[model samples]
Target: MSSYKKLIYFTLLLILLVYSVQILNIARFPSQIDIIKGDSRNLNIFFPFSLEIMEESSDIVKINSTNAERLSVGLKNSYNLESTNNGIAKLKLKFLGIFSIRDIQVNVVNQAYVIPGGETIGVKLNTKGVLVVATSEIQSIDGKIYNPARNAGIKVGDSITMINGIKIKDADHVIQLLNNIKNNKVKIEIERNNASFTTEVLPVKSKQDNSYRLGIWVRDKTAGIGTLTFYEPNTKKFGALGHAITDVDTGTLMKAENGEIMRAKVSSIEQGKKGSPGELRGMFFETDDVLGKIENNTTFGIYGTIYDENKLFKQKQLLPVGFQSEVKLGKAYILANIEGDKVTEYEVEILKLEKQNVPQSKSMVIKITDERLKEKTGGIVQGMSGSPIIQNGKIVGAVTHVFVNDPTKGYGIYIEWMLKEAGIYVNNNSEFAEGK
Candidate 1:
């Protein structure tokens, strides 16, 4: 073969190999897929190979090829799957003549509903136990610098639940327990990374204060302000933050042994800038009238029960919850309280929608388009984390995080996951009947 022809052939072969690898990389579908009954979804087949449905578990799922002829070499294909009935289905895809099979589990559910929330609320989280935020060098009576907590295998982020077989109540209680010990080793039970273990540490008498010290800094509580996402009227359950509230010092999720949500008023707004996220300064004084009790502080958000339904519904009404498929890239509005206790709607543009089969915090990228909101808060800020994102008169998602470089742009979490975290199940069949 001529050298020119040989080079051309080699280049073509390399391109084909690259394409094949790409197809193989994504050959398998996600373990489970969910769709509402009577809804249709498109599945993309990246490989240049024909596909045949080898098996289907239910007749409710109807699969049809959209571009089967395009499955030729160096081409792609797609299929449309429709759900006619609500049930689970198992689909088996076979690569034509390739002997490769991929299985997909499909769940056809009814519709869901949730009450949209945008009220700015105060979050006061008391950890299950005192958390070790930091360790320091203690100057003992002998004039020697000693790190008792460090030497005892206690690290930052560890929760000190008990000391000397006594349950620790708070930071002051921990201090009292350590000071009462007289230069002796004491057993400490701590929870680290979900594992519970025990350790012994010797308390040293501080020369400066003439008190026994453990060379550790601990915290028992954290408080902040954030937007409320949604509330389930049937269960009186509420979700907020759209993300976990981690300890500011330890950077770990605060285990909410007991917490409360209180009414807050935005006192001031600090506009966000590049690399510097702004915040909403608010005062929550009416602590006596507890709005809700926080139960779980998971990655999805904080789940709680609202005590006063009248207070939450006085300003806002229940809105329909939108599924991931219903979310589109277009204009949307967020409910937020930038001033006082009144919840107001602000315009934003849905820049991108990520179709995820699994739950995730950043389900969509949104940008603040409302001139009023942009001028007031400089786009999404710290306290706006759980602002309910409304599209087409339905609550689709919640604002989760803002882009550090662009304050106007931020991430959102789908409302479905927040409802799941709140322990609210969506009955699509009944929701559709109620015109939700």
Candidate 2:
């Protein structure tokens, strides 16, 4: 073939490859989208292609430029969808001249209600058993060092729940069990990475202490203070600590068999500075003011149900939860308790908003703008992790982490995700709904 003819053939092949990519991109959209009733959303198709909504499951949803006689979409490549009622609708999308058909599930749901939390509370967590924090060498009776835990495949972050079919309690309890067993091999039941297994471990007689040793260090409980994010009145569920409570030594998510939320008194404040994060030094009030029980410690936060509703902050009205899509880059406020038991609202500016389709902790970047807060805590401090952020009279998110280099700026988690982690369902149908 001639050189000119060969170049023309190559050009055609490249065009075909581009079109193929567009086709795949259009087909890869999520099959299901959710929206709240009376809300609209914009659905955009990135590539240059035509789309048509062939059928809808119910009359609760309406697509742009759609009529009863025929459903046709123009070559705009983007369309608006509105939910008129609360129901499920199945939309058939015909892409690229009917070359591919994709089904999109549209669900309309009700709006959510939750009480915004800003009180400083104490958190006490007890693991199912003792967590192995480290392994060490034990001097045995024969004047030799033996690492029984390492030899038995027990590593850091593993929870030793049972030994010889008996439940292990605290560190001292494990010591007593080992002393009683002496040098005999015992079955050690452990949980690692959410999986359970058993291994036979032999205890070494320590020459220094004249007792049996496992050559491991374990912890059974952890306590700290954090701000509350919200409380659902309908379910009596509450979420706090916008981030997970991980083990300080091992830096792993702590598995809580049981925990408590109690009132806290701020003793002192260590102001935050560049390259260092400050903290609120507080003491748990030793009273019968237990507010709730922590049942879950998740990546998003800690979730539980309140026992005494009267113990929580008395808000005249509950705040409407805001979805991530509705979060805007502008002025906002964070409710936090920096001083003794008094929750105060501080002004903050939402610097950046991230468009996230999945659940994530840091959804927005916020800066402390309130003069009083800056003077008090020097920006976002350690105990302000779960401070509720309000935007446009709606609870939008919570404070998660502070910027290491700039204490004045920090990351905020979308409140919708925290609510979901707390087992409170929000408007699920807003994911695919497009507004005009």
Candidate 3:
């Protein structure tokens, strides 16, 4: 081949090599990371490229130059970073120890520790207002059929906020307001799909009971049993269930304005089978007892502030939070109360993990490895949702779901998302974990 042909082939090879590195850039480096204070973390860097870490704020985070070592092939593969303080630090990454590649924003947050909860707790949640579950025709006193809510364009999942400008407290409150309405057509304030509007619903006197009826079934409260995930003493806040509490009738997320948690003891357990999910039967230790006030009901879980801390739990076991990146696929233990009020530790294994940049429920796949737990509850039962998963002396996540076909297996949500939902991780860089 001629010199010109050889030069052309080399130029093409160089272009392809550069393009490959640019594509690998997306996989090799993180855009941002959360470093725990006083702990060192290693950053992954591939061969053929050495990153020179320069901390913008040396006081917040310092790159450990001592831990940097040259590979057998004379390439830098990783860098160790120590978070010294609770603040944001900028890191200037370089390629081959010379060329600037990109800048990484580091959030050095204090290592947060909280009490890991395992005791079964009874939950009673009241919706913000009356949630319409169904609509039916009402039998009027004059033998007339009237569907007031349906005809007024109210939906099944709609929540009635007020009746004739009076704030609706519950289903019973709406009934009292409807019966006292002197006008035939009553003004109803409805909240549908996050937007609120007023619609006129005709009130009809029932033929049998002589009571005013709206021809709609509205529910204002729900109750169930779940395991507690965590309680942060610093914030006096607690999170539980690892999932939302939805209305059984309308299948809508119960928007909670007020609710309570109570001490509960597991009574019985139904063994799970393939395609058939089992449940843990529990009852409140004390009737009408309020352990805490439920403030918010969300997809993540139910969050609330526990004012009666002394009545809640016996001095609980505290553990640090393990971020998403810190959670590895290995053996872990979970705290679950299977018999009466006794909480026991069971072994579990993390099968898989997802690179989640955003908050999600299914962050890791977990399976029950302890025979004691499996024989007792047939793996993860219904009420075991918020059982705290502990690994490496940290609270890594909470049990969120169980596989219907494989009862021994289930999914867990990282504690990072739960912390944010519980308002304990507010304004901290500790929750941010970028994609690989």
**Structure candidate 1, residue pairs in collision:** 110-428, 111-428
C-alpha RMSD for every candidate: 3.8, 4.7, 6.1
Candidate 1 lDDT by residue in tens digits, 132-182: 899999998899999999999999999999999999889999878888886
Please report how far candidate 1 places residue 139 from its true position, in Å: 1.9
For candidate 3, the C-alpha RMSD (Å) to the true structure equals 6.1
**Candidate 1 TM-score to native:** 0.86
User: What shift in Å separates residue 198 of candidate 1 from its native position after superposition?
Assistant: 3.3
lDDT of each: 0.83, 0.84, 0.83
- Candidate number with the higher lDDT (2 or 3): 2
> Which 10 successive residues of model 3 have the least lDDT summed?
427-436
For 277-331, candidate 3 gives per-residue lDDT tens digits of 7999998843566778889888889999987777756567678899987999999
Q: Candidate 1 vs candidate 3: which has greater lDDT? A: 1
Residue 289 displacement in candidate 1 (angstroms): 2.9
Provide the global lDDT of candidate 3 against the true structure: 0.83
Clashing pairs in 3: none
For residue 107, give model 2's deviation from the true position in Å: 3.3
In the range 1-436, model 2's lDDT, one tens digit per residue, is 9999999999988877866766666656656666678888777653344445545544777777422223333223456778887767777666444555676777766777788889899999888889999999999989999999999999999999998999987888899999899999989999999999999999999999899989999999999999999998878999999999999999988888899999987889999999988999888954557899999999999999999787675644698878776789989999999888888999999999976655888899999999999998899999999999999999999999999889999999999788778867544434323321
